[model samples]
Target: MIREAIEAFASRSPSRFAILVFAAIIALFTILLSLPAASADGTATNFPDAFFTATSMVCVAGLTTVDMATHWSPLGNAFVFLATQIGALGVLTLASILGAIIAGRLGLRARLMAASDTNPLRLHAGPVAEGQAIRLGEIGGLLATVAISALVIEVGVAIAVLPSVLATGYGLAESLWYSIFYSAMAFTNTGVTPNVEGLTPFAHDYWFLLMLMFGVTLGSIGFPVLYALSRNFRRRAKWSLHVKLTIVAWSALWILGTIAFLLLEQSNGATFRNMNPGEQVFQSGFMSTMARSGGFALIPTSELDSASLFLTDMLMFIGGGSASTAGGIKVTTIAVLLLAAFAEARGRSSIEIFQRRIPGDVLRLAVSVLLWGAVTVALATIVLLTMTDAPFEFVLFDVISGFGTVGLSTGVTANLPDPGVYLMALVMFMGRVGTVTLAAALAVTQKGQLFTRPEERPIVG
Candidate 1:
């Protein structure tokens, strides 16, 4: 009976099915988290706080209404860690695995569903393209590759992080636990730390921060990108345009963001004032990396100057790569928009990059994603401002961070009322799964017009 229900649910449009799965998982976790055993004080948590935390965990957004180190018990922490993994793996990946297990083989419908959810770019490539055929095999291999790759990377990072954690004078068991927890959070890009101050204590520890940066970078780069690299490492096969663009955009954002942060925050006494040149350079780079869809912070965001906060908002809004643990409108969407503008400036009819023409459908999808994301963030901001005393800038920061699934906060998250907290959760869920899936789902429903209407011109700027 249960199998029948799952198969039926899986048969829906990929975006709707994906959203349903995420919502169901979040609901289950909310119930588990609201239990007395999930709290440190041996009392049941209020529904709003529990639901918010559960949403954050399952969305991999890392925004918290409660303190991570002090509020929850070991069982709660375990639940959070597990949810982070599940969220990062995503509903589509898990569903693919389960569907294969239940049916004893992956059907064409199931493959298309998983592919559409995880690698929507393939769908954009159209039906007769090699990408569509490749995706069928890719999804099957992705299940094992994603799970094993994440596990191995997390374990390796944990081992590297253990010595630093132990040197802080924690006992062996405690140090090991911290190591594992940090590893999971960093790799999953959830950014939930075992310490209340996050990575502040280890801010100067370059080695520790390096491992985390490595893990987060690898995780947010998208599984398809990584899989392509692994599969084509020694071969003469050409990398797909999607993989190439993702890598280029990913690198460009990190560099540009680092430079922007360094310049903007250089004079902020509360942030970079005490740090020397080398420390400043490293911290700026780290923060820039984290701002792009990473959840942890080494410095208090509230202390940064207004310009820096605004800059951080932009980076958070851009987020990380597509079809990965990271969220946001995606770098590819940004790339498409920029390329379109560039093409228009050159009086070209079609945007061309790397000898490939950008599809009109893809451009339309990009526009839709940008528009929806902006609207979602704006609506959340308006609601939070009305409900809480936080300034518009801080509220906007929280909203973009939630929408981008980048968990950095300006110390306003925990102070919000119940309505504000739920609003943030809605934005986070929408940011993580809702926007991307919704965009793709909407795109699939669009049919090319067979009949033409009279063309009209509107006044332009």
Candidate 2:
């Protein structure tokens, strides 16, 4: 009877099921974290702090009102690590994974639930095309890939960063644990540092920073792209348009952000002024990479110039790829909108990319995502501004960070009042689950119209 109820709920609304699952996880973690056993000083954490931390962890957003390295005890850290792993896998995907393990196979309903995480259209009441991110038949393989690839890459990263940690005068066991923690946080793009000093010690360690960057980039590029690349790495011509657009747009944004930071922050004494040209360039690259959902920082975000801060805001707002650990509207959405604009400029009616035509529905979805994301950030910013006396730039930056789940903050998040913290938590939740998924969850049902009204042309801009 219980199983039948769950099945009915999932069938009626997969998106709502996903949201409920995430909410339940956050609640569980909040309870665990609020316990005195989770704190370093053996005092119960206040409800607001505990709830916010749990939300950030479950959302894989690194924003925190507390010092992560010192505030959590070993058990609390364990809870955090587990939350990030579950969050990185996503609510529906993780549920499907457990369901598969329990049943030894996935049913059609299970596939539909998991597929909704990769492709939101699966939540709608219609047949989804095979050409979408991951087809129904391939969901099982995608799930395996999601689990296996995450483990392998994180292990590889830990191994790669171990030597650096050892060079810093740490014992073998401690070094190993720190390396593992860094690996998980970096690959998951949670951005929480294990060390209290954060990334300062490794600021000049190019190799270590580069390994973290590689992990962040891989994790940010969505699982579908990873699955596609794993199968078609040798045949570039066979790459799907989604994979191609993701790679092209992500790379382009990374380069642009790096150049922008280098030029804008080179003369700022607080960040890049003291560093030599080479050091400045390398640090700029690192900052640019981290701004895209990897939250590790060598310097405080408050030290950046206004222009650099604005640029970081843009990077955080656009964020990484869709259906990945990263947040924001997604790189693919921006890519689609750009393609549409180009088509319009060329006097073409249809959007085409990589010699493939994009459907009208995709463009519509992209527009919706963009608008929803902007509105979410705007509303959150307004609320936060009213709640605090912080500068507009800082408030907007933190709001976007929460919305993008990018985890970078200008010290605004740590000082927010309880009410503001709750609001930010809500933003992170919406940002992580995605605006489309939230919209689908709120919708009672999808209706179809049989009759069409006559279309009329309106005045243009």
Candidate 3:
């Protein structure tokens, strides 16, 4: 039956029929958690929390409706860990590539499967004559990016964080595990740290903070963007528009967001009240980056002043860049939206960038993505606030953070009612699966597919 479903999905379905595979991957972990031995405390669990974790995993959203590091058994935790790995790598269509490679089944279906992964918005080509090709090398490169990036950053974090964990007097192996767990915890932005009090214990520890900040920030910026940048650092002209836009917008936002945090929290401070200038800047800068869907924290969210928390919420809502590890609407999409607005302001008919015109279809899709993402985030935020005692702003912050897969919270995640966790898990699912794919699924099609409309005028200020 599963085989039949795969065949049907491969041949003809919603382009995002691929996402259903992600749903199953989410379900598998839930099943793992539901098993009698899944919980260390031997508590018989309902399927809801387990399902929530599954969605969280596949969506790459890290809200654990339950206490993850302690509540679940080792095996259960292992399943969650693997799910994070899959989600971090591409959750929807990428699995088919893995399944085929492992089974040695490179049939026509496999070829067609590979095609979907490499679509390019090549405006220079005028029209795409064919679907973009996907290569084994490219697929391997993606996996390698996720694996190597995760390892180097995670392992380095483990080593870097050792002094702090060791201060707890854990044995070598146990400290080793904590180090390893925190690495995964930070990078995956899963928020399920082995650290007893999460980042609370490491709040003022610089090296520990640095390790997590890097892990979460780098891991969220989808590897594709990084790969392009790493290879094209010397030639700005050769860089894809996507790469250029991502870096420009991300850098701008990070700088601006950092300042917002510092200004908002500087003097009213619980955490920052007595800190020197340099420490305050570092803390604000790091936390703002984490807010860009990284989810790491050098300071407790609870200690943040109300104004600072609002700034964090804005950062979380904006999230990270596209085709990158980060979530939210993506920096590139946001840039495109702003560029489109600018074009209109200047009385231009088409959105152009770096001297090249962005096709109307791409702009429309970008708008659609942001539009749907805004709606989803809004609805999710409302649901969370209704279900919990947390302040409206904090819940909105958590919702965006989770949806962006930025796992930072206002210290309220552990105390949420089951309904609250479930709402958050759903938001995370939408965020991670991505707004574009979700929008595509709902769209009315030409011959049942969406089509570009000719430019039209509407009144605007």
RMSD to native for every prediction? 2.3, 1.3, 3.8
The parts of candidate 1 lying over 4 Å away from their true place are 121-134, 234-237, 439-450
What is the C-alpha local distance difference test score of each model?
A: 0.82, 0.89, 0.69
- Report the number of clashing residue pairs per model: 0, 0, 9
lDDT of 1: 0.82
lDDT of 2 by residue, 133-196 (tens): 8888889899989988899999999999999999988899988988999999988889998787
Instruction: Summarize candidate 1's per-residue lDDT along 1-461 as a digit string, tens digits.
Output: 98877777666455566677788899999999999999999899999999999999988998899998999999999989989999998666665656777777888656765675555654444332545113676777866678888999999999999999988778999899999999988888888988766677787788999999988898888877777777886662477777778889989999998998889888888888888998889988999889987777888888888988998898888888777888888888899999999999999999888888877878887887899999999888887888888888998998998898888898788899887888899899888774656655555464677999999999998
User: What local lDDT does model 3 show for residue 437?
Assistant: 64
Error of 3 at 347 (Å): 3.2
Find the 10 residues in a row with the least total lDDT in model 2.
95-104
TM-score, per-candidate, Cα-based: 0.94, 0.98, 0.86
Give the higher-lDDT candidate: 1 or 3.
1
The candidate that wins on lDDT is 2
